[model samples]
Target: MPPAVEARPRDVRGYPVPAITPWEGGEPRFALTDHGRSADCARQRRCSVCDVPMPPGPVWRVVGATESAAIAAALASGEPYRNLAPTTEGPGHRACMLYASMVCPYLARPNARRGSSAERPDELTAHVVRGAVRGELGAVVGFGDFEYAVTETQVLFRFLDLVEYLPHDTADTHLAELRAELGRVR
Candidate 1:
């Protein structure tokens, strides 16, 4: 009989590691990453309740295209998103979704002057981009502070919050499937 090959682990940058995930039965278990650990440490230092060591890992969730698009749009629009603040300095709970049912009309509103060119939409675009990044990060890791850029076609989905911590090959495969599914909806 041939021996089964084990899958290797990869870092955030896609470099290979021995194996960050622990194996018990046949499945692998992931702990927190370095960034998560640092955040936990910072939290524990300030909060009286967070005295224990933090687990460095991510929690995964599968979302629909509509939800994903809405989130992407929000990030690109630059609205202020909500996140948790540490009570003292300990790790806080995970972030929850911050949704706005309708798109803000500020960007598409008509200019007052009939003859003049439409009002510049840059301000609204910037606001939406900022807000989306803040909000998405808040929903993922409980608290996040990252800046993002927006584009005309679709929002750039580059926030750490949007990152899935699966193995590199697995993550790539999943992304491919997601892209295909998204293409079908369009």
Candidate 2:
């Protein structure tokens, strides 16, 4: 079994190297995100975590806490409201999911119960993008400060307005499959 998650997650070196490196596979992908913030981002669209150009179509990303405020408020107030959903990050790769799920506190910690929030949701949410998303993508929180915390360091995004949302049920279910894939990697 994979080791249990610690109270705090630590970075593992040499992680997320693509199974096939550019040397072996061909060119590394790089492109500007549809909502990228900087010219630099436009020139180089890489996973902030692994610095890889995310492959096209079907990647996951979580909406920032601020954007989820409505969801939280609704959950807290017990009122039904428009679901403020987590959206996909602009074009990026998902190769880092296993390592990320292992070490990222924002993700399910090691040994997170199968049914725990670590596992399920109407929408695909990752501390970072790990699967595919469909819906009104909220904001593209690009450049921001990395806030250090006991559990892990987190990046806070500068959010934009609510965008179109894809039907929750219609969202791709790749996250569930990816979660299962972690068992093999671990």
Indicate which candidate wins on TM-score: 2
lDDT of 1 by residue, 148-172 (tens): 2333322221223443221121122
Q: Give the alpha carbon lDDT tens digit for every residue of 140-179 in model 2.
A: 2211211111112211222232232111221233345445
Best prediction by lDDT: 2
Ten contiguous residues minimizing lDDT sum, candidate 1: 95-104
Question: Against the hidden reference, what TM-scores do the models get?
Answer: 0.20, 0.29
Model 2 lDDT, full chain set = 0.31
Q: Each prediction's Cα lDDT score?
A: 0.26, 0.31
Backbone clash total for model 2 is 10
Instruction: Give the backbone clash total of model 1.
Output: 23
